[model samples]
Structure formats: C-alpha cells, structure tokens
Target: MYSRLSFSWTASSWAFALLLVFPIIALVYEGLKPAEEIFQHLMATVMWDYILNTVLLILGVCIASLLVAVPAAWLMAMCELPGRKHLQWALMLPLAMPAYVVAYIYTDLLEYAGPLQGALRDVFGWQNSQDYWFPEIRSLGGAIFVITSVLYPYLYLLARTSFLEQSVSLMQSARLLGKTPTQAFWRISLPLARPAIVVGMSLVAMETLADFATVDFFAVNTLTRAVYDTWLGYGSLQAAAKISVMMLFVVVLILSIERYSRRKQKVFQKALTHEDDSRFVLLGWRKWAASLYCWSLVAVGFILPFAILINYARYYFAASWTAEFFQYSVNSLVIATIVALIATAIAVLVGLYRRLDTRPSTVLPSRLSSMGYAVPGTVLAIGVLIPFGWLDVQINDVMQWLGMKGPGLLFSGTMIALIAGYLVRFSAIAVGAVESSINKVSPSLDMVSRTLGQTPVKMVRRVHIPLIRKGCLAAILLVFIESMKELPAALILRPFNFETLATYVYQFVSDEMLEYGALPAIVIVLVGLVPLIFLNRSLEQAH
Candidate 1:
C-alpha cells in the first residue's frame, strides 16, 4: 500500500510540474517553426537594435544597482548611522512602487513645463528653450535611473544579509594589521560577499530585462517591447514567439553565469553576535554623511513617488472614485485572491512530496515549477497563448463537429489565461516559502507519525499543514501582493473589457494623465507593502 501511495504522489507531482512548465515547451516549439514575414522584416530592419538596447539596459541597471546597493548595504550592516533601524527596512519600500509609476512621477517633476525645470528657469533668469540643459527623464538613461532606483533594494537586502553574516573576527584582524575601515571592507568583507552580490545582481538584471512598462513609457526599443509589438501590433504570434525565445536565452544565460560564478566557491562564517563592537563608529562628518546617504536613497526611491501619488490621490479622489475604478479594484482583488490560494496549495503539495520521498528525482518537480519566476512576463504571455490558444481552438472545432454552437475563445480569451500566466510567474514565491518552512520541520516528526500507523495523507493533513500554517499564510500573502502588482502579464493576457488596478494605472500613465489613476496606483503600492513588512519582520527574527 505504501509503495502504491508513493507512486501516486510521484506521478501527481510530475503531472503538476509538467502542467506548469508546458507553456515554455510549447513556446519553444512554436518559435522553432518557420519564421513569419514580420519576423524576417524585423531581422532586416531593427531587430539588432532591440537586442543591443536590451543588452545595454541590463548592463547599465546591474552596474548602477551594484553601486547604489553595495554602499548602502555596507553602511547599514557595518557602520553606525542615525535612524538605522527604520532606514534598514525603509530602503526596501521602493520595491512596492512599480518602476513605471516612478518614471511618471519623476517625468512630471522634471519636464520643461513641469515643476522642477519651471522653477529652475524662473530662479536662474533663463528665457526660453535651450537656455539651460537638464537631463531628459524620458530617454534610455532615464529608464536606467528609474529602474535602478526601485530594484537596488534586491541587492541591498542580499548584500546586507551577507555583510551581517561575516565573522567579526576577520574585520578585527584586518584592523590589527594596520588596515583602515575602507581597506578592510575592500579586502576582507567585499570578497566574502561577492557570491551573494553576484546573485543579487542577476536578479536585478532579470527584472530589468523583464521590464516593459517603464521601457515602453520611455519609448526604448528593448526585446520585451519587441515581443509586445510583434504580437499585438503586427498580430504575428510566430514572430512574438521567436522574440520570446531570444528573451528565454537571455534569462538562461543570466542564471548560468550566476551559477558558474558561485561554482566551487564557498565561504563559511560563524553566527553573528549582536555585539555593538562589530560596527564601525562613524564620527562627525562621516556620521552625518552616512546618515544622509542612506536617507537619500529612501527619499528618492519610495517617499517622493509615494508622496506625489498621495497628493494626486487627494485632489483627484473625486475623479478617480467611480464605478469603473471600483470594478477594476474588485477585479484585481478577486483574481489575486484566487491565484494566491491556488499557488499556495500547489506549493504545499510539492513541498510535502519532496519531504516524504527520498528519491533524487522528487526534487525536479519543485525546481521545474519554480523556473517560470525567472521568465520575462511578455515572453511568458506569448508562451501561454501558444498552448492555451491551441486548446481553445481544439475545443471549438470539436464542438462544431458535434453540430453544436462553439464556445468561442474559452481558455485563451478569458481570465483563465490571465490566472495561469500569473501562476506560472508567481508560484515560485509560494514554493520557496513553503519549502523553507518544511525544511525546518524535523524528519523525526515524520517518522514518528508514520510509525503511529498514520497514512502519509493523514499525517500531512494533521501534522505538516498545522505546523506550516504560518509559512503557508505568508506564501499566500506574497503571491497575492505580487499578483496585485504584476503589469505586463496582466496587460497581455487580460480578457476583453477586463481591467486590473495595474492595467488601469498603466492606461492613464500611458496617456500622460496620472492624476486619474493615482488612487488605484496607491492601492497597488499599499497592497505591496504588506509582504515587505512581513518579510522584514521575518528577516529580523532570523538574523
């Protein structure tokens, strides 16, 4: 009976993993077929430019994120600064503010007729156009800046954790050997944190590559934009799939490089004690400088954009508070709730399977299911359409053959495709959370439960589920928040006349009228903050 049960679990796990991964497989198959005329036209005209722009955007964002994140991380982890407790988590708030939102706010603030440039012209006694030079906030450089501002926190969180985990003994030894604080950081600390930094940079690069709204708003021609244009603009799924294949290659390359960098490189450090002596005591100017730098990042990244939204929401509240706004908010809430529950359920099932089964192959389901998180949303959207669209076609054809009215566009034309795209993109959050929680449960508990004659299913229901309930809740909330904020997939896969808060905000932002969308934008940011707060508390407790 036990052997049969194990086989059942194994099959179920593989089935779920394959269901989640089938879109990418279908995408590759479609992409490998003969190219459409539009794709050939793109290859002849501007495809190389799109590829170059994407490469440059990734490189720029990675470099800029490193520079911003490393110094702030070092300050927070190793140096004494004012408001350190609040500043530590405050740095992460920008992750809640979507990059496109920030781009809109900053462009409004800095454009020629906008407040900043207008004030500068008035104060400096400048006349008309070309009187002075101000950096354009709608160029490739602008996209890099706005994206880096929001994404640096990924590197910050990882790098700070790495710095905190380093042995204090190493720093003390370096200081005793006549090394200054900066020298010690360069030699002893930075090298040890290199692996973590590299991992963080890869994440930032993937995010920058996946970015569509900010790049599109800025009118930059990157691969994500190409994918969107090819599919929707030219109505050629084949060309879109081909472009998506290029993006998949980029994603795989980034992950490969990150893995290769950490290959055979390992560092072990003793638990960091909560000792004040571990931190460098900044004095006078240095102290103020550190404080200013940390706070500046918080201000630019989160506070300013958020503050602008608040102001807009207050004045435009009457305009934005209507039936349409309410409907979109409800739509976002309902879909996010459904996706959260389903994704968390999948996480629990696969997680328990990994824990119970001892075979090496049991690990593949969890790994395979998590790959969608790294895929760019536009690419994932195309991947999803290829298979689900075909399924919809098959369903309709069979119905017509049976002399019945066809249910038109059942899968690909409804919320089913949207939710599936979301699950593929965000299920990894729940899986990672559940897996981590499961790892904390002792194997002896499972053994004891089994020895008591409890079947695996019964043991899981009574023992595993109850114990990991908190992690499960966290997983649900994280997935919910991510779904609320996801724009590209929502934009591509939403059914006719269906709008989420993300799509609603993007619509107004695209029209250069953010005031109308400010209220919904605030909702997205507020929903996003819940997970960051939970994450911060968890990290605090763990450290």
Candidate 2:
C-alpha cells in the first residue's frame, strides 16, 4: 500500500513534469542551429534596432502605466473617493482592449482622414496631410500610448492591494509627525508597497516585451514583431527561433531580477487586521478633481471606444447583425469557461504539490508552472503546435505498428488543441491567485483538524476549502478573463472555422474594417468587464 501510494505521487509529479518541460524543449530545439547562422542574422539588417525598440516600448509602457496606476490606486484605496465601489470596474475597462485593437482605434481616430483630424480640417479648411500638424499613429510613441492605456490595469490591481494592505498603525505614526495624506502615501505607502509594485511592473515589462500584435499593428518593428516577420515573411523559422531564444534570455533575466528584488525586500504582507487606513475626505474642489481623474481614465479606456463602437454597431444592426455573432460569442464563452476551469485545476494540483513542501520535489514543477507568464503568446502557440504535432505523429506511427489506424485524438484538429494552448498561456493567473490564498491558510488549522482523526483530504475539503474559497473564485475569474482576452495563440492554434469574439474582432480589424468590427469588439470588452469586476470584488472582500 505504501509503495503504491508513493508511486502514485511520483507518477503525478512526473506527469506534470513532462507537461511543463516539453514546450521548453520544443522552443530550444527549434532555435538551435549552426552558430554561424545566428551570428549572420544578428550582424545583417539591424538587430540593434530591434533590441532598442523593444527596450523603449518596455520603458515607455512601464513609466506611463505607473504614472496612471499609482495615483489612481492611491486615491481609491487610501482616500474616501466618492463612488469608489462602482468606479472600480470602470477603471479597469482598458484591460479588455487588446493592445492591437487600441492601436487600430487610435490610428483611425487620430489619422488624417479619420474623424478627429477630419473635424479639425473642416474647422480650419486644411487641404492636405502636410497642411495640418497631425502625428502619425504608426510611430513608436503611438504604440506606447496604446499599450500603456490597456496595460496600466496590471499595475493598478497590484498597487491597490499594496495600498489597502498598508498598516493602520503606521499611518497614525506618520500623522503624528504632521505629514499630509499625499506625503504619507509617498513616504509610507509607496515604500511599503515596493515589492507588490515590482511584481506588477515585472508583469507589465514581460508583457510589453512579449507583445506581437500591437507592434505588428503599429508597424514599429520590435523584437517580437521581428520574430514573426522572420518566421512568416522571410520563411526562416530557424532565424525566428534564434531571435526568440535571445528574447527568452532577456525575459529570464527580468524574471530573475524581479525574484531577487522581491527576495531582498521580502515585503509581503497579509492583512492581520482589516482596519481602515485613515481615509482622507476629498471635499469640494478636491472631490471634483478626484472624480474627474477617474472619469477621464474611464473615458479614455471605456467611453470613447464604446461610444464609437455603438455608432458603428448601428450600421451592423442595419445590416442586421447576424445570428453568427451570438453563435461565436457562445463558442467563445464555452471555450473560455472550459479552459479556465482546467487551468484552475492544474493550478490547484500545482499548489497542492507545493503544500507538500518537499524541497527537491517542489522546485522543478513550481518553476515550470510559472514559465507560462514569461513566454510570449506566439512562442507558446508555436511550442504547443510542435509537441502536439510530434505527439500526434508518434501516436499514428504506434497505431500503424499495431495494425490500427488512428487520428490524433487529444491534440490534432480539434477544440482540445485550442484549449491546451490557452491553458499553457493563462495558467500563471491561476497559480498566482491560488498560491497566495494557500499561503494564508495556517498550518495550525490543519494540525487541529488532523488531531480530530479526520483524514488530510477531508480536512482540506471541509476546512481549507471554505477558507480559500474566495481565492479559488478569484483565480477562476482571472484565468477566464485572460483566456477571453487572449488572441495571438488562439488565432494561431484554433481549428479551422473556430471563432471566438476576439477572433471575430481580429478578422475585421485584420481586414482594415475597424468600423464594422467595432460592435463585436465592444462585446469582447464588455464580456471581459464581467470577470474583471468579479476579480476586483473578490480582492476587496479578501482585504
């Protein structure tokens, strides 16, 4: 019995092991070629430009997002901001806008022939492109603006928690020193929130570095966009893989730095007491200013995009927006729901493995599970295709040997492949949420339950489940929203004719029909809003 139990545990661990490492093997194997080839590509046609552009995008998005998220999180979390309860979801609306979609919208809105410039031209009677001062939306700055608008929510979410988690006693101490609320936040809250902020910024940086669609849409030629160009345009998968390997090294370095900073600071805090953090009243003009700030964020993130979408949706309605739209929406919801559940399940198993807390045992699986967050969507899709393709081939060969014919059941030519790709991409969301919740579950509770002669599984089910229920729900919603928002991997890996709401929007936008695309595109954002709101509500309750 003991041997069987031990083998079962080991089998479980090794099963997850292959799931984690196989994709990485695919990435490395594809990238490895003669060093001469890699060096030649690096030397010819401006690798430095690619690197520089990528760095600039990361830096610009990081700085701009911080500027927006920190102040917003501070106002909402620390002050008595009016309508804080309702405004939370509104603040997070930009997250639903894929960076590529944002690029398309802004380019159309700001371009010479587009509405904004056309209105200006009608007002001033400007004749040509050079006649009026209009910034090109295809430029680096334009890419930065689109990315920062959508990505700031990452920083906002983390910073909100850090703010809400600020010790009430520390705020009182700061007040006794005669510091104002703003001063206290900068001096006290900001410093304390450093770790969480770093975590958030790391996520933003990694995401910016990994983005392909946004850079591709803007035609800015970052490393990610370059990778795709080499792969598809030049028909050099080897060269693309090499570029990807180099990019992977950079991401690994960033992740390492983040881990080091987090370790050095060790600035994790759980709310031992949920006391209010000395909320200051924003009276009269101050209140108006605060409300205006929130409104402006929502306007840029939500209202402007939505209003335009609504205007164009009238056209779709006139065309009698087909039943196909709802069909695709249902398809998207069904897939998103399944993938989110599976991702959460994988996360639960991974978390449980960690709770076992055996040193060498936990190390590899934990690291592998976190790899999803660091990998680009495109790379992950490629990774999924390689292994699943090879696995299908191998299975067919084995079946042939056995005098039986079989097509690839789990992977090839099915919705399962799409879901597998999604799980590979979005598993990090589940892991982060579940691990945090599990950490807060004290060992003493388990100890007491074990003393009552209940089995460990029963204790976890009856006691642990109830305590960590909020975290599980949050994790599921987070993963669901992320999967719904996911594009590149889904675009690449979906079986023929499989369309999600994201894919529907992408099809129109890809064809340069942003106006016609606006309706379903808005639906994507609205659907995403539901999960985002649920996540915020969970986080607030957890605090």
Instruction: Tell me model 1's lDDT, rounded to 2 decimals.
Output: 0.92
> Which of the numbered candidates is closest to the native, going by highest TM-score?
1
Give me the displacement of residue 12 in model 1, in angstroms: 2.3
Q: Give the TM-score of each candidate.
A: 0.98, 0.85
lDDT of each: 0.92, 0.77
Scored against the true structure, residue 514 in model 1 reaches a CA lDDT of 95
lDDT of 2 at 78: 77
lDDT of 2 by residue, 1-543 (tens): 011124455467557646865676787787786645544766486888898999899999999989988889888787777787777667887877777777787788898778999988889998888786777888999988888888888999898888887767777777799888789888988998888888899989998988877787777878887766665577555676677777888788888988898786656554553254467667889888987897788777667877877787887664526777888888888988998887777776667566644455665665677677678877776677667877788998999899998775558467877887787777778888888888898877766776787654576679767887888888888888778778877776788888888878877777778777777787777767787767677786787
Q: Which pairs in model 1 have colliding backbones?
A: none
